[model samples]
Target chain A: MQVSVKYFASLRELMGEASSVIDIEENISVSELWQSILESKKVVFDNVMMAVNMEYVKSEHQLKSGDEVAFFPPVTGG
Target chain B: MLIEIRKEAFNAYAEMQYYLDELDIDGQYGATASFVGTMRDFNEDKNITSLTLEYYPGMTEKHLETIVNGAIEKWNLLDVLILHRVGKIKIAEDIVLVATWSAHRKDAFESCRVIMEQLKSGAPFWKKEETTTGVKWVEKNTPGF
Candidate 1:
């Protein structure tokens, strides 16, 4: 299964790419996918907000094929 | 209700007037409360030139709609408007405008404030500042108490 991963704001700068697609095992949790990605790049972000298909979700949320996942820092808009 | 995310700056008063005039409320609203946020020249004690705002496109509009609809239901508001700027914005320029209309001042005032507070904390917009030294992303927002 493949899912599209997106990074925004500071995360985008650190990731060096706005978005990418990765193949993953079925029913992987959001945190597991993030850990795998970060470990490969030697980067760490302790306070990340996660979203699946544009809706905010917990780290333990399960992923599915064709999901649009987003990771970003805490919001700072007015 | 009207929700807008624009790359250009806008006048809060004019936007509010235009939106309110178009509504067919038939003099149903007795109070209108609004809040306008502007860019400041300094942050973290450093002088700043301008800032760029980034968002998640479709997700941003959805989140804002949820916030506005929640406020309207919670306070029974008659009308609401929210406008936020994106891309580069100079210091002292308007960054956002939130206005609410209700039958009384209490509902209008409270709903307007609640919407702003929720938007500040929950919205997916990110701000990157151009300071005197260099550019940096804002990690957190000021407490909305």
Candidate 2:
């Protein structure tokens, strides 16, 4: 399955891409998918928030194909 | 009720005036209050430098909308507008624009305050400041935002 991941703030600076499409193993949970991202993009993994379908989610949640995953840094704006 | 989140900068006086007139300002409205948040040159013993802002494109907008709706429900507000800038921003630049109109001055101030407070602890946008020393994440007054 193919999923698009978006990087924001420091994560974007680290990943060097605003968004990317990757093919992952089928039936992967959110936790496993994040682990893969860490393996490939450790810098972003260090400081980021995970979101699926525009909603913040925990690692145990299951991800569906073509989900728009986003990684955001800490809160900044007032 | 109106909500806008974008990367481009906005003129404070122009945006505020235009929105007020467009929303059909209530002549009885005793007060209209605004809370403008700007990018400070320094933070927590850090020297002045540049500021970069980021946000969840989809989630940010959605959350902002919900917040606006909440304010509408709770206050007798005539108008409310939230303008946020994305991408790179400079020091002392206007970062966020929030305005509220109501039948009374107190309501406007209270509503605007509530929106900004909730936005700080609830919005999905994040900021990072880059200085000669190094870059660091911006922290909020309230934890777990």
State the C-alpha RMSD over the true interface residues for candidate 1, after superposing those residues: 0.6
- Chain B structural similarity (TM-score) per candidate: 0.97, 0.90
Candidate 2 chain B, poorest ten consecutive residues by summed lDDT: B136-145
Candidate 2 local lDDT, B1-145, one digit each (tens): 6678767777766788888777665676778889888777777878858877777767988888888899889888887889988888877778888998888888898889989988887688888788879988775545422
Candidate 2 per-residue C-alpha lDDT over A5-26 given as tens digits, one digit per residue, 9 for 90 to 100: 8877666767788999989888
- Candidate 2's C-alpha runs over 4 A off are A25-27, A40-47, B6-8, B139-145
Residue by residue across B1-145, what tens digits does model 1's lDDT show? 8999989988888999999889998679999999999999998898999999999899999999999988877897999999999999998889999999999999999999999999999889999999989999999999879
Show the colliding residue pairs in model 2.
A76-B127
True contacts kept of each: 0.88, 0.65
Can you tell me the CAPRI class of model 2? medium
Q: Candidate 1's C-alpha lDDT?
A: 0.93
Q: What is the TM-score of chain A alone in each candidate?
A: 0.96, 0.85
Q: What is the Cα-based lDDT of residue A6 in candidate 1?
A: 98
Per-residue lDDT of candidate 1, residues A1-78 (tens digit): 999999999999899999999999997999999999999989988799999999999989999989999999999887
Q: What is the lDDT of candidate 2?
A: 0.79
Candidate 2: Cα lDDT at B78 = 82
